[model samples]
Target: MMKLDICQSEVGTGLPSYSWDWWTENEANQFPQELEPSTWVKLSEVPSSFSFEEALLLCQCSPDSWLAWIPDHGEAVLHRSQFS
Candidate 1:
């Protein structure tokens, strides 16, 4: 699997407020099969400061390739497969 280092955007009141910087086609494809395209939107309510372990499970990311900053939460390393 390919690993992607993404910078997460700040949270907003509505959808599309968060974006993953540096994610490529291959990296996006690495997401898990159980993930839906709309899942991210659904989970957008998750606090930005959430933990890496929490983001891993929340995003269903593989534990090795994921990394992001959740505003007040801090930062974490997550897996590409988690967002499938």
Candidate 2:
């Protein structure tokens, strides 16, 4: 059970557009099917055993998307350029 804050880039400011926490339960059903459970981890909960590559795959994001880490903040997956 970790608090996963979903952050989206705002006007290239690298700020979070929206945030949410993850707690295994009915919440998973509420999210889009493409989002993998392991795609996120709170900034403080990032495990030492985890790797960026692993997160990328688990994210199951589109080819045009990219993941970025904002220290002390959280990890984010940038989707289409227009929305970012």
Compute each candidate's TM-score over C-alphas.
Answer: 0.24, 0.24
lDDT by residue for model 1 (1-84), tens: 999998886666454334555556886667555543223311234454332223333333453453454444655444553323
* Tens digits of per-residue lDDT for model 2, 1-84: 999998774665654434344445575456454444344433333334332222322343566564655444346665533121
The whole-model lDDT of each prediction reads: 0.43, 0.43
Model 1 root mean square deviation, Cα atoms: 15.9
How many residue pairs clash per model?
12, 0
How much does candidate 1 score in TM-score? Answer: 0.24
Model 2 / residue 16 / CA error / Å:
24
Candidate 2 residue 65 C-alpha distance from true site, Å: 6.3
Model 1 collision count: 12
